[model samples]
Target: MDDGFIAKPLGRRQIDQAYPLVCAIAPGLGVDQWRAFAAALLGTAPKGSGPGSSGPPAEAGIITVQNALGYMHGLFSYRVEPNLRHGRVLSVDNFVVLDLFDLAGIAETLLRAMDLLARRLGCAAIHTTLPERYLVRDSRRNPIPDCFRTEGHRQETIRFSKDLAVVNDNAPAVAGGLHGVE
Candidate 1:
């Protein structure tokens, strides 16, 4: 679960490849823990990533990092274009960032998973309220990790947007419309 791990969607065939990723990190997780994770994931990820996909055996992409201290079981679901008072908003209907091992893993997994979700959903931007060390850093510069301040800076800011327009229209209007937002 070191944030260093890379996560990707797993097809049925590659799920087995996850064993090493799991055991390698939480070496002492035991049968019950594995069973619980398996059960939870089965309930959530039986088919693919989607809202109401399943329950406890939740659904989420697997995180992988060679020699990582732990792995994670992430379950997320969202209401895209959700109806709001005026228009619509993307509400994360179901989202849980869990670290099956050390607490430090929580920081790493949550940060990485959000980063992945923002990009995958074509979100203009993503946001979070976690305090700063929870904020990923770029050598700890003054706002070093502002998520979108520059290339490769996406990991730096917690309260960030994949595309600012999704949250606020006040952003400088783009000529190409929302497509040019990013």
Candidate 2:
């Protein structure tokens, strides 16, 4: 069944309505911070100032889907990044859906929005970082990856480690370590 939800780009004037949803996702952040985030994302500056005249250049935007009750149920923030490997890439971040709902549908709708934004911006690929909570526990996680897989994206696990202590002379260096002999 459709949830009677509609998705679209969020604007600066809608911050008051959006803040509660933002708080639902990140309770620790203050309301003032949310206001700043909305401004930064929507690329709005104080009156009489030029674009980005307030601070850093706008690098993100929020896409939100609200239900028939006019309550936002899905929220996703995406940014365009120049990547050496993927040219201009769109990175989806800080995605949140109300816990009581099925996330798969909301996620799909949001990704579709992200894809359109990416295409419009000439992005070559889309990337996102999923938290461990979603990755490990949510039943919705399966469909989440499937959404990307259907679009030809592949998943890879990358691991990195460093020894902070001074190395002992007796320890043999790995092939790419500082002590490696060419």
Each candidate's TM vs. the true structure?
0.30, 0.67
| RMSD of model 2 against the true structure | 8.0
Q: What C-alpha lDDT do the candidate models reach, one value each?
A: 0.41, 0.66
124: Cα error in model 2, Å: 0.1
Residue lDDT tens for model 1, 1-182: 34455444434444454554445435555755655554454454545453212322222333333234334353323332433342433333223333446434433443455555555545554433332333455555432233224424334323533646465755465677765556
Q: Model 1 off-target regions past 4 Å?
A: 1-4, 10-71, 83-90, 97-101, 124-182
lDDT, residue 123, candidate 1: 51
Model 2: CA > 4 A from native:
1-3, 44-59, 137-153, 157-182
